[model samples]
Target: MLQLASGSSLLAIAVDRFLRVRIPVTYKSTVTQKRSWMVVAICWFTAALLSFIPMFGWHNYNTWNGTTQANSTSFECRFFTASSRSYVVNFIFFGFFLPLLAVMTGLYCYIFLTTRRQLRLNIGAATESHTYYQKEQRLAASLVLVLGLFVVCWLPLFLMQTIKLYGPKIEVSSLFVHIGVLLSHVNLAVNPIVYAFRIPKIKEEFKKLYMRVYHDGQQH
Candidate 1:
């Protein structure tokens, strides 16, 4: 549920950035500060409701039998291992795939429209628009990189899970599942660096910090 809400929030930001660039006047009126907060609130509410529903008897876990127990611990709990394939399928679609698809679509569409607009600008407007367009292009490229990283990190996990659920029965090694999960987690670590490198202000701050550390080392 948290994942769903986070993805939705990111998607909203991407869409908002695109609209601000493409249709500034209309976007100002339609996506006001209050409206943006409202969108976030809605995402949170929806995620909470979906997540809470599973707690009300949808989730199935393996039952412990004394003879069949893997360990002597009586408090052991294993979730998502039961015969409830439907729950897994629904989680994949709603929690990951749908939100990812929406974000990717919005980002690519924004890139396309920005490129078209750049190409169509008149000579008279070129000088006035050159700096603005350049900045937009940089930001868009950064976002594209971020989106690519997101796909790379999550796609394998998503695909493997989907296959495990829907494909022919086969033994899937725990090592393979662990690797996929690790790759998915790598995104959380990489995102901040991606943003810092892409944004001019953040990049500048990074440079300043680097220089400060370098100078202090030299003095010592």
Candidate 2:
């Protein structure tokens, strides 16, 4: 659900960026504004659908084929049964891993471009050229730093999942899953903190929100 929600939000931001660059004049118009919001709504709806299908048992949880274990944890419904392990493995790999990999790949590409631009600007600055290169460099660095934090925070969970999938058949305890999931959940909250504290626009917005609430409370 977090993946779907956060993914949709990120997708909206990307789409907004694309629209701003591709059709700025149209982006400002009422029609375009309505259409943009419609697109966002569709994306969120689709995300919810993706999350609900497996959850609501259009594809039911897998159980060990024709076998009931006496000593095993029968209370826990085995979502990935021994018989369906291969299918579940593939699903996890392609569904989650592939998309995560793709996102990281894109992040790397962005980092590369940002680094290259910063380096070029720094070289120009060293040569005593009059350029707004320093400001651009700072902006680029900030973006890269945020992206790097995202990668750092998420990579550990991905690595843990991948190892459990393909490596040794060590029994995955609930504790491990809980820890990994907690770490992953922290990323969602951490991202907003980073944006609010480190990004000027977000910081200003935070201040406005804080002041608005404080003033409203005082008036009451």
Candidate 3:
């Protein structure tokens, strides 16, 4: 659910940026704060809806005619174990991941290209054009870095889950699972780094928090 939410929320940002680039004149009017919040809310709600489908017994009905047991005795609940093969293998990887990847990639690429072309047209005519272009590129770089990190980190876990869902019962190392989980979580750390560079308020608060934590540790 967290991954789903993250991906969807990022997609909203991509869409917002796309609107900003493709329609600058109308961007502010269309992409208002209320609308932004609405989009985020919709993304989270949709993510939760899709993520909880397995829990709501959608996974009980398999791809075939087989019906899964409603109850289990297992203490440790793994996603691959709890989820249906269809949900784990097909829907998440194919339906969500691939489509989201394609859409976000397309949007960011379009935004970069469009802005670059526009800047080039105004190169000598506008003195501030270079500065604005650099700003756009920096923002684009950060956005891509965050998205790329998410993809790189989560791909391994999804692949592992797919293999576990379909492949023969082979004892895989828990270490590998833990590593995959760690990588997926590491994607989250990129957000703070990007925010620190982009938003001064957040950067100030982060510095304060770090100093407070370090002082407390030293006192102990």
Candidate 4:
């Protein structure tokens, strides 16, 4: 539920950014703070509702063999696989893929159209537009990279789930499963790094902080 909510929020941000760049006048008038908050509230509510449904026995966690073992400790804890293949399919399609597709489409289309419009301007106007366009390009590129990393990190698990649903029964190695799980978490770590590097203001603040820490250490 938390993951779904977070993904939805990211998608909303992408949409907001797209609107601001592509249709600034309309966005300014329509996408006010109150409306944005309302959208966020709806996303959270929907996420919570979807998550709650599984608790009513729509899904089962006891299907995996490792979970049935009595001696398993916290370190040996394995994630629960859904008992129903349909549940997995529904989750992947609606929860991850659809939202991802929406965000990618909005972001990339905005980038393409915005870039094209900028290109069509006179050379003098183009030079004047460069700074603002560059900023938007950086933001779009950062979001795209984030989305790419998200897909890369989650693709293995998604593929594994799909294979389990359709392919012949074969024992998947625990090592591979663990690696996929680790990769999924790498996005969390990479997000901050991406933002810090791509945003000029953030980069400047980081440099200032680093210099301050270094100077303080020298003084001490």
For each candidate in the order shown, give its overall lDDT on alpha carbons: 0.68, 0.56, 0.78, 0.69
Alpha-carbon lDDT of model 3: 0.78
Better of 2 and 4 by lDDT: 4
| Tens-digit lDDT string for candidate 1 (1-220) | 6545656666776776777677855777988889888999988987787666655666554432233344656534333344244554557565656666776676767766775577467434656466566666667777777777877787776666677777849666666767777877777777779878788887889889999999999999
Error of 1 at 112 (Å): 2.8
Ranking the candidates on lDDT from highest down gives 3, 4, 1, 2
Q: All candidates' TM-scores?
A: 0.71, 0.61, 0.75, 0.74
In every candidate, how many clashes are there?
Answer: 0, 0, 0, 0
1 versus 3: better lDDT goes to: 3
Worst 10 residues of 4 by lDDT: 77-86
Clashing pairs in 4: none
lDDT tens readout by residue for model 4, 1-220: 6656656666876877777677754767889889999999988997788666666666666744345554545575345454455565467545666667676676877775785577566335646466566667667777777777767787786677667667748667667777877887776677768767876777888899999999999999
For residue 198, give model 1's deviation from the true position in Å.
1.7
lDDT of 2 at 94: 59
Which one is best on lDDT?
Answer: 3
Model 1 has a clash total of: 0
Ranking by TM-score: 3, 4, 1, 2
